[model samples]
Target: MKLPVWKEGLAYPQPSEMSYPGGMTRILAHDGRRDLLPFLHDCTITSHEGRLYLGWYNSTDAEICGSSLIRGRYSEDGGESWSEVFNVVGEIGSAEEHFVPASFFVHEGKLYSLITEMGGKNLSISLDLFQAPETSLDEWERVSVLSGGFLSNSSPIPMDTGDYIAGVWMPLKGDTPAFPAVLISQGADIAKPWRCSFLYDPLAPDAVKIRCPEITLIVQGSAVTAYVRNDEGKHGDLTCGPSFVFTSEDYGESWSKPARMTAMPVGNSKMFAGILSDGRRYLIYNNDQGYFKRGLLCMALSEPGEVEYTKVYKLFEDKAAELDNRVGVWFYPCACEQEGILYIACTLQEPDGVRSAVIARIPVDTI
Candidate 1:
């Protein structure tokens, strides 16, 4: 693999040397002798009606190459032990039709799985929602919305005005470069007919081409801060390098021009950030860069009700970790905070080049 085009110093305190959540449970592993879908990624977590559920897409080898299935597991005893694997979105998907697990959220007393349903219209995708009531996972009913061509990375967040904003991005369409975008709900309803807004004009005269994006938003009153993965390190420097950032003051109605997150070490990877149950802010993403980049997952936090992340912790590393296969890469982390427990689920790559999934359950007080 080629090294990162940009250079930034390693994180101040090394990740491997710090303490991680104790008894981190390995939810499930790919059984070569039994399973058909070997490659899995984009894990999402949410708790509904007294049960905790985690979901991800199990693909063939490359993403969106062939059929992809949304698989998952449930835990009744608060992340202590999880049930055997089961299908969340069992409909078959292919290169033209692919199902990527977006964040799972509950609204109006009903649990919903926001899916990035890709297919048709020459690789078009939309935020597809699904739900299965309390007694069964055998059937999931599809919920309708008034939108298309949008990719959802995280669940919707309620802003100060009772409205919600969900971090999303527009996929590459022709010469247009994909950039960070936002989807805002109207009048406290997270349903269809979203008002979409982009951080930058991708087709502008001086627009810089970027790689794929999964934006994360930090909301405070009328001020909102958004961050996205910088896979193409062509827009930043060693100082405020990597991670692209954008801000809004009127509840995501509009955004400022694209800029790098000031003086932070965040780099080319999908990150999860949100306000904790205790009013503190927490972020989960990979640390370091280059070959071992995604192999090191780290966490950062801020004081209660503060936006600045002053404390950091080394969450996990791909040491000789084995889950039916030697673990190597851990990426695309999605987190959910509930009942004072932070449930972080991520994709785990193995030595054979296939992938698995795991959820790290940590108490808020332990952070």
Candidate 2:
């Protein structure tokens, strides 16, 4: 297949020091001192019943200690403003456990939040459900803890057969590294049985090892495609590498061998793959040249079942020099589209090790 070339002659958005086009780059939450709330990352944004909901994980520091908890905020007016942050999971003295927000979406007229927990002898995934018509932050109920080794921050896509396919990854039992997998829901009831299908196993002798596989699924007709993150860089610089792609013809039951994507350079960070309201396939990722240099985040356009990207747009970039020279400026992007506008949520690390969660709004029609 021929790789798509970057679209030229189109007027791109003017760069700004503090904001992006439409002045939509605004900080939703931040920790200045790194003492009160140390780390804030893995942000996911979604619209539910006309309200914008932002969910992320926070801890005393950047570590996955017992002090980690899931936090959420709601925006009533299209993300122009937001409510005070609140704990979606975990408590003040819950030092022995960790609860991280994995995914949030509405399915079957019900709002659902997936929280992954890690504690002593316990590593499980749980579901929280709220009635769509009359749901509030206080109304969420822990429904069930999904069995098997399924964990991801990407939301599941509803299949034509009425089931949902969630992209997940698990650590290998022995010396092998982790790889991507699919969690097949039984039906509309998310609390029911879920079967697991391993897509790419790096431990196999013939398999291509993919580290930290943050798999995002995109459904096109009867086929489901995955863009797996190749976290490990080939040059040991943790920088430029092609993302691995896989497809499943029989729903999420089976998948094809992984292949390197063309015309796209993905960093060792997470990337998002989703369809726009206009039926165009888009991917948001860090198109940096070196490892941990997530300052350049770009969006590209592609067609269904196509490995090559046709057009590219610069969404945001942080040019400020890193104070410590060890940390990147941007990473962990999560996005969703509504009414032709794309809302992207990501974490911005400051020079002094402080991290803040920010969201950017881009008019999809302009791209």
Please give the CA lDDT of all the candidate structures. 0.70, 0.68
Worst 10 residues of 1 by lDDT: 1-10
Q: List TM-scores for all candidates, in order.
A: 0.86, 0.84
Candidate 1 regions exceeding 4 Å error are 1-11, 21-34, 90-95, 120-122, 233-241, 320-326
Stretches of candidate 2 off by over 4 Å are 1-35, 120-139, 201-203, 234-240, 303-307, 319-328
Global lDDT for candidate 2?
Answer: 0.68
lDDT of 1 by residue, 1-367 (tens): 1111111333455554566755444444333335577777788788876778777777765676677667777788776667787776645544557777557777778877777777632265667667765667755767666367777778777776877788887777877677778888775555557788777777888875666777888887888778787766433333224677677888888877677653456757788887888888777877745523577787777778766666677655775343443567778888887687887887777667766666667888877
- How far off is residue 254 in model 2, in Å? 1.8
